[model samples]
Target: MDRDDETSSTPPAPAAPARASRSRQLRLAALLLLLVVVVAATVRVVVATGPPTWDELRERAGLTNRDRLIIGVKDDQPGVAQKLENGAFEGFDIDIAYMIAEDLGFDAPEVTLLSIESEDRARRQARDADGSFVTVDLVVASYSITEQRRDQGVTFSFPYLETEQSVLTLASDPRQVASLRDLERAKVCTLGTSTSEQRLREAGANPIGRNRISQCIQALYDGEVDAVTTDAAILAGFVGPRPPGELPPATKLLRPKELRHWDIGAESAEKWGVNTGPVPEMRDLVNLSLQQSAKGPDGDRWKAAFDRYLASEQQYSNPQQVAVGRQPEPEETVEVRQWPWERWALPSPGRPRSGVPSAARAPSRRNRRSSGC
Candidate 1:
């Protein structure tokens, strides 16, 4: 073979540095693509697992749009829930409303208490101080949780208070009303659309429906009705304090001395719950607040409220029955999802964990802890 043919057959070698540079550039490009994919996947996972924001919680609880929380409460049901002369509400129900509102991130001033009648409770419509009708976020009135009420679109939290039917009559009246049967064929005044009215009908009493319990009380005083029937706690409020000096100004007109309290002695109890109206999401939030109140170390709101409003009235009411006014153990379980930072921020065992999804199934009656009321 000729030297020229041999030289043409062999290709010239490229520079080593140039070859190395091209190889390095390919590897670097692959690494950068891989890094981008990894970062994107990590960001997606974190977002999906992250804890809910405060605004999200309020939105889910159906209170995001409103700056203040409006609660429906009874203005006339004296120790259970009543309006004071200073235009403030003070009572057990009012205290309970405060507890729930605090848990919901509202201050005392951010809560608006509106007067709600028994019939309007299910509708969540309350009358403001100016007599305008406003929709309430919650009904902390002496609202009983019944299956029928649930069917009617009222979603309630777990029971907070358990009471039984009671009758209040004029002390001067000769009727000895120890049980429901004693009121048979007699005209009894009860709030319309109330559990007491149904019970009165079952006991063969003629129930006259009124807009408010106060109206029933007035009817009883005016000799228009034989007695006013409702929960014992409410009746005890009408009776006021046993001591003359301790008599609440609101009850002075009721003439506590002339009011007679009769324990109806029923087997089943009226389990009072916070009415959430049509919002089912509010149920768990309310249940958790109540659970904290009953069990948490930092949560003595329920006990304090009971002592302040209902404790002293036990003298005029049924001591045994009134003793059961203790706060109920929440029946439902609450689960919350939180970030590591959130857990570290709130280390107290009493603080409710936030953001975790709860169990969907309701606890069976057999598995539920009894409130002993």
Candidate 2:
């Protein structure tokens, strides 16, 4: 009778623990299957995206950073790329920099200018007051495209403007020295490490080495140096009409009637071009913009820049004021605009030396010309 009663108790519902364990096992199996499915789906999505295609990479390459481009440039250059009093940059080279920024899909405000030296163009880096490093993305100074500079690991754009060497002499000087040959032993101011130095010395000039072009100008105005010599475009900036209290703009051009403006010779007819940060793609892009400026529509950008900033009697052209690689007589009348120097001046009127820079007056004409030849 006891046995029948126990069997009729439903065997304690097949043991409560056994029932619970079977339910937990079923849930665990389902979770594992779900996790595996999710992992497979994620891998498929990753495969679909892959790496960015060439087109996308090309777009990103133009951006120096998230939203702006840092360009290295010379600050004191008057006609090429002067850093203006308003903290804005102006000149033919400045215009070129802006155009390049635009072509790379950047706007005016999106570009940053770092004042650099002519020597520092190849290695683009500077230290801030806080001692951090600042690297330039592009360089648009009056940088000359030379084989030596090219070997420095920086790539240059196609020749956009051709610059020729020329001389600036006093208008009142009775000598009226017309050719390089006439400068026998006269103190001539020229930049060191430049071909102008050798050429001036060869021409029998007592070359006065100045670090920046502005110094040479100051020296000439102060009568410290008899003459200032450099690229014609550079000299033209000073020869235009001027207001009182400023350096006399009535300077004379003692150019030869040979083939070109470069007094140094065929090699001296150097092409002023843009420099890229060792970026092969950037070289291509810059060249394209340069080409468009010369070959594009009526309102060609480069032509417009030439009209506004570089124009006068000595305006720039694609082929240049004088023929490249040839010595020629300069035009009889060169009409350059003599705007006030202080009007849209550079951030640093003087080129940078070992330390900081702005224009400081030449050291009291340390070596004044005692006699003129």
Top candidate when judged by TM-score against the true structure: 1
Q: What is the lDDT of candidate 2?
A: 0.57
lDDT of 2 by residue, 1-373 (tens): 6988878976445577888999999999999999999988975675465433222333546654458778887656555656544455556677778776665656676677777666667777643336565888888877767787777676877766776777766655555555666778899887765557777777888999876677776677667778877776665555443223322111222321111122333345756767777765566555545554554331266665665555642522223352232212221221112224522452111111132111221111111111110
Q: What lDDT does candidate 2 reach at residue 118?
A: 61
Which digits, one per residue and each the tens of the lDDT, describe model 1 over residues 1-373?
9999999999778799898999999999999999999989986786677544444656787677767888998877766776645566667788788878777766676778888888888889988768989999899998888899989888889899987777888889997987888999999999888888888888899999988777788778778889988777777776643333222324234322367778767777888999976655576677767877777654666886787777767766653355365777788666455556765776322244342111211111111111011
In candidate 2, which residue ranges exceed 4 Å CA deviation? 1-65, 126-133, 242-268, 297-299, 313-373
The alpha-carbon RMSD values of the candidates against the true structure, listed in the order shown, are 9.9, 16.4
Error of 1 at 44 (Å): 6.7
TM-scores, each model vs. reference: 0.76, 0.61
